[model samples]
Target: MTAQYDNLATLESWNDSFKVSPHELPGERQMRARRVSGFLRARQAELPVVPAQEAASDAASGIADAGRKTAQIEREWVSAQWGLVPRWVKSEKDAKLRAPKLLVALNETVSTTQAFRDAWLAGQRCVIPMQAFYVEDLRGGKPVPTRIARVDGQPMGVAGVWECWKDPQSGAELLSYAILTINANNHALMRRYGHPGSDRRMPVILGEGTYDAWLSARQDKAREFMRAYPANWLLANPVENKKDKKPKGLFD
Candidate 1:
């Protein structure tokens, strides 16, 4: 499964890229593990589990449909869609109308639209738990099929915002989310990636030390945690993409 975003690629099938791991990603384990560096094995102890809370309001969004899903890591990981459906949506068909974007830029949210304001001030915040995310290796400002992960092998927690909507007919509430991004033009690791004209953005990855503060911070206090992760701590590889698409769709 792959989640397309901002015409970019990634390590997990989530976001605007596809994830390929030595270990198949966990389906429902809250204590998820990234693919082991050299081998696929039963290994949960080697990595730390990201502490996440499924949005309190979305616990009942009846979006666990058989055909589509959204990804949100909570007490455990589950197969979910990579898009965020507005809490006001009433149909799957209507969801396509918003042309969901997978990312929400912090600077832009302050005045772009009411939805962003509501999500921000309402504390609709969420985090995408990732082992690694993909970035294009650039040469002449073009994207080369490549992936990136943590050199230290610890999972990265990406900041995000979530919303819940209901199916008009089924009355089932569904939860959808978007990852937060920040400009990375100054970061060596992230600056090295992106296609020509592609936004130089990287997910707002939080360390174990800051997870709770980020998750619980009020709107006015959230920005302090948006800084970029140091570039030297990551690893990049030229793994083949599991599947590629004819760049279509918007971010959600």
Candidate 2:
């Protein structure tokens, strides 16, 4: 989408707004964390999820038996470590070294800006699955937490890039990924969500029915998938999070 007034003028604005990607500073990640929300704290039950692969497989099968088998099976939610550790990383410690460069991008390969330029061109595309994301309301000065979700309430599939990094030291491999971002300074939803310190930016939430295209699309056409999701299709609710009571500091 073109500049929405919620824009920061740059194609990729640092998420200066209170809105933060679950992957961003994903503090205290797990060896395996449920893709379903609330895995962070024991506040709810994990839900049976329809894995995107199964859905695609069912659609592609066309065979009656395959369809029947798919109908009888339910996929569990995905469990992935938060935050991206690049393919070249040697260990968690090493990945942390690259996080500042690989964690997120304004838009992968756009204007050759992202550090993962070669990987992006090689079609190292992935999707981040989420129920809802949190953002801070900075407009009022003091930060207020807000939960943001699709108005339709379906899980969001955010655009991202992924790669496999093998540790030269131990031959162990790690899979990591990062969310793509885009300017949203003029967006009805985002402009209203962030504080002046970080207003008008957001992740590149993909459009409905675009998941497969994102994964399989050729690199030259990949940027086509970077379009901004409309703000009206989303809603933000003010919420509370006392678990980490540390008062947020500037540049947090």
Candidate 3:
């Protein structure tokens, strides 16, 4: 599974839906392996101020100004590296080598996995806001990317965990997070994706009402929210290029 996803485009959506403001809105609309946005608890009374980055054409494009905004004491939006970097990492070199391998932590073993166990036990949970996530359908004998999103068109809050790793020599801090995935071997919609003979898995997409609870839930209670989202509530469409509806040799 690629585990790639898209992010919110407007500041209003972040404010109205998630009820938090971003420290720095990600420049890229589609979230990949680098720095991405995440919603987590705020421990400070004051948030930092960054200059707004926008042009006159921003309104025409329907994209909001990339400005720093305040957040509630309970929750805040922060940019974190897509991969999880455990605090125990001895060197920056080791961190880079280990991050890619730790992007998705299995819910079944998160509590025991050394890389994620500390974050899980410490209740460092977060919500990854996304417009949609892409999955590959291999039934046709070749990978075809499919975009799965909520039927209501609202952003999805995928469950995750964050950590702060400090460089021993430079003392610089690296904020990182990882998506928590669950087995989808029996899922109605998700089971249709992934390799046919292998075990299928998907990110834990949290419900609309569980944002705050998920960020603060104890380890035991957090597991209660790891269930699969209803298949009917989601819609899937095969990604197609604008120039051509059908790619050359895709079906041949």
Candidate 4:
């Protein structure tokens, strides 16, 4: 997939579609690799859930944790860079140079990939809300920008992982995220996009019912929701202009 996409334009849509309050509106509607955009993630207070039996055992042994509580799994919208910056990065300059190449994490190796391993194992999964994602169709011999959205026209909640990095020099924290992609070589629709000979891949689109569940799932169980979105449910339309690759009629 390309390093660009479109996000929710209005506050009401962001609130209704993702069911969270964004502290600030996005300045840009179209997002590129390192742009700051809003994403939904479960509140950290309830993450890494403790099993009921484990909590009960601790309580009986007089070792109950004071901060432990039943899993409420609250979600919040956070403004983070679209490209993930590993917490281990040594410098801010290195982060800027590395963000673009780290835009998408392969689902097959996300758990083991060096750049994403810390965030993945820390249960930093998130949902990226977008109106649609852009790709280039080269079937016609030249690149033609294409807009890929759901057939129903509703917003899509894409699966991703988030991270927070601290500038070792300035001590400022940077929040960022990366979309998780799966092999689309066998997909009937997605296979038509991207480069001609390279392996096909697409973002992991989650179902409406699984948004909260995805954020609450344990690290090991998160992969269960990494299935590809149905090709028939998606609609792809050629953008009018390659340079100004905005969705037709909507932004005008």
Candidate 1 lDDT tens digits, 35-106: 111111111222232223443233234222111122232222333345556666667787765524433445
Model 2 residue runs over 4 Å out of place are 1-80, 90-92, 108-114, 195-199, 241-252
TM-score: the better of candidates 3 and 4 = 4
User: What's the candidate order when arranged by decreasing TM-score?
Assistant: 4, 3, 1, 2
Tens digit per residue, CA lDDT, model 2, 106-133: 6734337545665576566666655566
For this target, which candidate reaches the highest lDDT against the unseen true structure? Answer: 4
Tens digit per residue, CA lDDT, model 4, 164-234: 99999999999999999999999999999988789888999988877876877655456767788999999
As a whole number from 0 to 100, the lDDT of residue 92 in candidate 4 is: 89
Indicate the residue-level lDDT of 136 in model 3.
Answer: 91
2 or 3, greater by lDDT: 3
Question: Which runs in model 1 stand beyond 4 Å of their true positions?
Answer: 1-80, 96-100, 103-107, 140-142, 241-252
Kindly provide the TM-score of model 4 when superposed on the true structure, using C-alpha atoms: 0.86
Please identify model 3 stretches exceeding 4 Å from their true place.
Answer: 42-73, 241-252
Q: Give the TM-score of candidate 3.
A: 0.82
Best by TM-score: 4
